[model samples]
Target: ERRFSVDLVGEVVRNFTLTLWNTYAFLVSYANLDGWQPAAGGSPAAPAALTDLDRWILSELHTLVGSVTAAFEGYDVTGATRPIERFVYDLSNWYVRRSRRRFWKSGAGPDKQAAYATLHECLLTLSKLLAPSMPFVADAIYRNLAGAQQPESVHLADWPAAEAARIDPALNHDMQIVQRLVSLGHSARQRSKLKVRQPLPEAAFWAGADAAGVIARHGALIADELNVKQVRLLNSDLEAVAYELHALPRELGQKYGSRLPAVRDALAALDAATAARTLLAGQPLALQVDGMALELLPTEVEVRLQARSGFAVAAEGGLVAALVTDLTPELVREGLAREVVRRVQELRKSSGFQISDRIRVRFQASAQIAQAIAEHHDYIAGETLAVALQAGAVSADAWLIDAESLAVQIELAG
Candidate 1:
């Protein structure tokens, strides 16, 4: 309990502080330069077009507003705190993390503008929602985000009203499915000893019929999050999975008191594979025992899934993910490119380069690393904001980064 408290407090402080500060920096750096404000008249127009991610976040925000408001009105402090905590988590980890590139891109296109507006709105709303729980931090956020044009204090501002029309249950459901698959993918990678930095060819998800379409719709998002080349929603992959069913003796015995042994024998004789598959497919398993017909419900049996060889599997609450462990030459090259980018970024930070500073990169490395850089030259250059990338000796002033059997040097371009 003590450790749990410490961890939760640390997570809240780290995530909330960094994310809020970053949001303030973004608004000051980008939106202010564009003369944008969160006030009613001065704010940028609502995005004419919203991505699926955008809509999902908006819906989640609406839900948060309703939940928090109801909790406060009912005098339930813990309930109110829970919603605020969850919203902060999703806003920082999911929304901000995924949409960072949009905010960082140089130009102020429609997409960038929409991203800025959406984040601004979210931050402002969060200020009001959090004011009652965290007065000082909430007030600071509200003032920085809204004080310039609106209320002088967050406490003086009216509570944000939830928008019912913006809520989309279908989109929220799909996003939840995507989140689950991404989590399972992380577990599979851990089990296989594969770092997320190393790219994989594919990850497979076995979704029920009701959720298969939803999972397929967000295949690209899942693939990117998992750092895999592709995502396959394998509705039929269950054939490769084996399942075992254990009859709950207590529950079965309660129903068949005198005939418990007979019922147990009938269950033991049932075709395990067929029964497993039938139950997994959400169909009832029927049995003809002692001249009586009976159908088995899920509660009467416990199911366990076993994966075949060559796959890393993780499952929870009826959802399963099977990640392919085989890595190809092309995938390895891409993985190396990613590693190079990571190293260069680290060098930039260590060398005290500004976030907006463009630089020239120079490297002398092994033949394999050289090939990877050459093949993915454009990607490396764009990601690091490099004006030039070349292969050769490192300059005396450049920062040197060494990896296993690979070395590279980078310097800020004048």
Candidate 2:
């Protein structure tokens, strides 16, 4: 009955593989798996010390287990598949994306061990859940993650029962709100045409009292994802965004004919905020003009948000996330430093350097970029796993970022 898009199907498959399978592969690649016996995707592993982030993902995993289990029991294949897809997104984009540092940090400490254990458990459970729909991939992931700990194949493994004690509903609710705010922040960044790599000064949010607590708890994660220096709360949504009304000229012209201009004028005269609210609430906008009353559906008009000065804002479902678009000198320097690290990392990859390869870095750059390197020397060194950074002749590859050319070389640490 409805139009189908091959692209949509492709996107879903790609997201599922990249988030679940590829992420698992990445973890296994980096993980020091010697003597580590992964859990058999049973009840959740309760690490002695768990960060809020760790606990949050565990909660999500168990919740997914309960939902998928119920759906499969009812023979609702679609329901089972959909929840797995969503969990893959959360695990890949939110959990793994945020926890990459823990896995990559120099030492195998308790925190690192916990992370490995938690992720391993998740992938194992996910493979079992996916077995019915995607058998081959599920068996492959389960075999790798579980090793000799469980049945050789995922189909032979027992169903992962939901761990009631591990599923924290409150934590899940808070994380959901945090994810919404971060998603809005990303929209704002897209509108501003600024990439995530370019750090911004601050992001402000306006939401209900309920979400205030969530924002307070996960503000650091939000800031990290949005590439903002700080997260602030605004008392009102109007402070973050103003609505602008637009008439769909062609549609309105076809509907109103001779009265199209009058309709456009009426729309322009209406209070944008009130009109937007009415339309978003699924009510027709009522206008009185020229002694006539007219009601226009949401389809006849467009609503645009005008961000407050120095901010790029996105608002939806009563939540607003605004990013301060003005780049301060210090912020610009930090962004450049990140760009340099990214380029260096790319060079390392292209040069066939292993993830654990420590390197000596040498760079020749324009004055401004060189200054950025000087200011954030330790940061760049730490991020790129550079044993030494020196000013010298170019050797490897040259990259031009922000109109500044940087020639950099990285060699294995002696």
Candidate 3:
């Protein structure tokens, strides 16, 4: 086994680097832009003021603290380090990535304040937890997030204690189900060669009774992540897929010889649902084919559920998720608009504009792309923080999105 290989070391470094840059540094920069400062007490907002996402991450944080504390107390350094690494990944990838809109929304309110407070609390606690293992990096993060709120050095700060009152096991379980469903949904999309940016009509998940509440609470997040208009809870897997009887040509050919074709036809004609149930119940299928009675063993026929038309599906551990892949004309146009927003945002970054900088955009695009821009003008402009969008001549740095040439130029709004 290559468990301790250099590749593992590289992966560890990459994970830490991504967490630090995307989560820690990015949040710090945004805080500065918003003129936000951490509270001296370093307390999170009241539960009622926080969103489900905020509560979920905070719950995860306390859980991590408890596990790390127990591991360190028992001298299990590896156990302690493993949880810390995983927490950082979740903090960056899920929490921060998902809360970006909350942070970016204009003006100040309880929601925005709660988002900042929750994130600050998480970072402050993490700095303290990492102090023993990573003294220098921990100190840097502590100084950046805590400022004058806490001890100057992370090493001087008290070890973080788990807040048991904040930990909700039920919420954690629901979030786990939601994450797994999202993962399965993404896999289905990939299998269908569908891009994440392409807007779809609906996605459905069936993970038994336990997931009912989970879907009700977190379905919006799923729809947003999967780029679907709606998230539907499937009552049964049958709604998303159809089980059909497939006769094994080789096995049936040996048994029935010249009657094999007729046998296949008979199996195909049988009510697939009834035949599947009968076969699964360990009974052979009784069929009348060409005036000959046929008894097909379970091994002679394969039962498989075909994904419903217009859906790409994936299943695991009795859970099934399906993504509707059919694209309507409106959906296609909306997807194009999303692509335009992505390109413009990329150009803004590459052009070195500040995050708060309002921009004016001009573009020359194919007819289809132009039509998308015209139809979704407000959405494209609002998303990109663009003051105006005008049709004009474009420069050489053109982008190709969905096989359509789009050339855009952006400047700071006057």
Candidate 1 segments exceeding 4 Å error: 1-12, 15-45, 243-310, 395-404
| Candidate 3 local lDDT, 173-289, one digit each (tens) | 998888888999998888888988899999998766787778888889989988899998877777877777889989988888898888888888988867876775568889999
lDDT of 1 by residue, 323-361 (tens): 877878777778888888998898899999877789998
Ranked candidates (lDDT, high to low): 3, 2, 1
lDDT of 2 by residue, 222-299 (tens): 888888889989867687789998889888889889898888888888788878867754678898768799889888
Record all residue pairs in model 2 with backbone atoms less than 3 Å apart, i.e. clashing.
none
Assess the local accuracy of residue 379 in candidate 2 as a C-alpha lDDT between 0 and 100. 92
Clashing pairs in 3: none
- Each candidate structure's TM-score, on Cα atoms with residue i matched to residue i, is 0.81, 0.89, 0.84
Q: Which segments of candidate 3 are over 4 A away from where they belong?
A: 2-5, 243-305
Ten residues in a row with the worst lDDT in model 3?
17-26
lDDT of each: 0.77, 0.84, 0.86
- All candidates: CA RMSD in angstroms? 4.7, 2.9, 5.7
Q: Return the lDDT, model 1, position 223.
A: 88
Query: Arrange candidates by TM-score, highest first: which order?
Result: 2, 3, 1
- The candidate, 1 or 2, that scores higher on lDDT is 2
Error of 3 at 361 (Å): 0.6
The worst-scoring run of ten residues by lDDT in candidate 1 lies at 396-405
